[model samples]
Target: MRLSVVDTELCVGCQCCMFACARRSGLGGIASSAITVRSMGGMEKGFKVIVCRACDDPPCARACPTGALTPKPGGGVRLNASKCIGCGRCAQACVLGAVQWDDDVNKPSICIQCGYCVSFCPHGVLAMEDK
Candidate 1:
């Protein structure tokens, strides 16, 4: 599947994606959501959409000593928290800054491509396309 961003100009800087990403654990919590979008300088200029681009070669997966990060069937990274050692190396390895830190849990929050956040997005900015 291809991760597509359409009509990004319509984004409201609401950070609904961030909160949705945090809701992937199916518990309506931000403890495990992995995406984040924030303002570049100010909200007036628009928001910066930050999410895993389903990289062909993901550095975060490579940096995980415990192999917690793995390749998803569609083309994104899947995080196995049980295997993770709470190391921040994967977060540092992600160039897109898609990997978020769970301050409360002291672990990396990686996207699972569940599209839960996409459903919560009020604006039609994020979409999952079968490429």
Candidate 2:
């Protein structure tokens, strides 16, 4: 699949992408989204959109000791919390900084390629395409 994002130079530095990404968890709050946008300085320089690049060979999956970060046959990695050991190896292995650490739950927060966050983005910053 060809995954891409719609980067607009006209971003308003509003962290709607962050809140949108957090909404992908199906929770009422914004804790599960993989994307985040933060102010550069005082919102004058604008915000930075941070999210997973959906790598071809995800290094995070290789660092999981419990097989919690297994790659799906279709694409992307499938995180199994039951098999997770809470080790930060996956986080360290991820060069793109996509694998996040959930300190509250003591687990790694990984993106499963679910496109829920794309809908919440008013700026159209994220998308999942089929190759």
Candidate 3:
């Protein structure tokens, strides 16, 4: 089970992981990435990194009228471009705020837990752990 885990105490707010995620989409920009790193509030609070939890029962899928969001082989939902209507329902259904979006394309960008971002975390904040 290769899952993305966060060691928040080790996080240095470098955002290297986030950049790697964007690059995984071959878009060379954060807009295409599924992960998000933002200040929890301010510098004193460090940052809050958001990624899909790979829920056993994903709410985003239940909210999709077109069934565009469906469960992956392991966890999380895979985006079926052909079935998607760009309604933004998946983004709104996520309780963790992990169901990110591509503003230009109007689609949900949930993490596949691929671990690409883990490699870029110089501070050992992100890891691909076998659970």
Candidate 4:
């Protein structure tokens, strides 16, 4: 499965999806979320929803020096935190800026495509579909 942005125009910058993503990991705030919602300059310009696009050939995985990131079956990558050296190369490699940083663990927080956040998006901005 993959999490898709159905319509960015429907997004209201509510950040409900981000909260839900973080909550899936038993976190209390957006800092741990794999998804992010940010203003496009200001509220009038709408918002940008940043999440892994599940690239067929992910550059982030290729940028990992320690082999901590391996490509997932469908797309994206699976992170092995124990092998991660906190190099932050993965974040820099993501062209979409989808790879989120976890300051607490000093690791990347990647979307597993579990679709936990889709249900929380009140504006129908997100969806889960088969790859």
How many angstroms is residue 34 displaced in model 2 relative to the true structure, after the best TM-score fit? 2.0
2-117, model 1: which lDDT tens digit per residue?
55677668889887777777656556656666777778788888877877778777888889899888877657788887898898999899888888898878888776666767
Q: What count of clashes does model 4 give?
A: 0
In angstroms, how far off is 126's CA in candidate 3? 1.1
Worst 10 residues of 2 by lDDT: 1-10
lDDT of 3 by residue, 39-109 (tens): 87886887787778787778998899998888876667888888988898888889778888888788877
Residue range with the least summed lDDT across 10 consecutive positions in model 1: 23-32
> In model 4, which runs have C-alpha deviations exceeding 4 angstroms?
none
- Top candidate on TM-score is 4
Better of 2 and 3 by TM-score: 3
Cα displacement (angstroms), candidate 3, residue 38, comes to 0.7
- Give RMSD to native, each candidate: 1.9, 2.4, 1.5, 0.9
* C-alpha positional error of residue 27 in candidate 3 after TM-score superposition, expressed in Å: 2.9
So what's the TM-score on candidate 4? 0.96
Query: Residue by residue across 1-131, what tens digits does model 2's lDDT show?
Result: 53456674556766676676566665655565566666667777776665666665678887788888887676567789888888899889876566767766788777666676667667766666873
lDDT of each residue in 5-78, candidate 4, tens digit only: 98899999999998998898786987789999998999899889988989888999999999999999889899
Clashing pairs in 4: none
Better of 1 and 4 by lDDT: 4
lDDT of 3 at 73: 68
Query: Looking at candidate 2, what is the lDDT of residue 93?
Result: 89
* Global local distance difference test of model 4: 0.91
Rank candidates by lDDT, best first.
4, 3, 1, 2
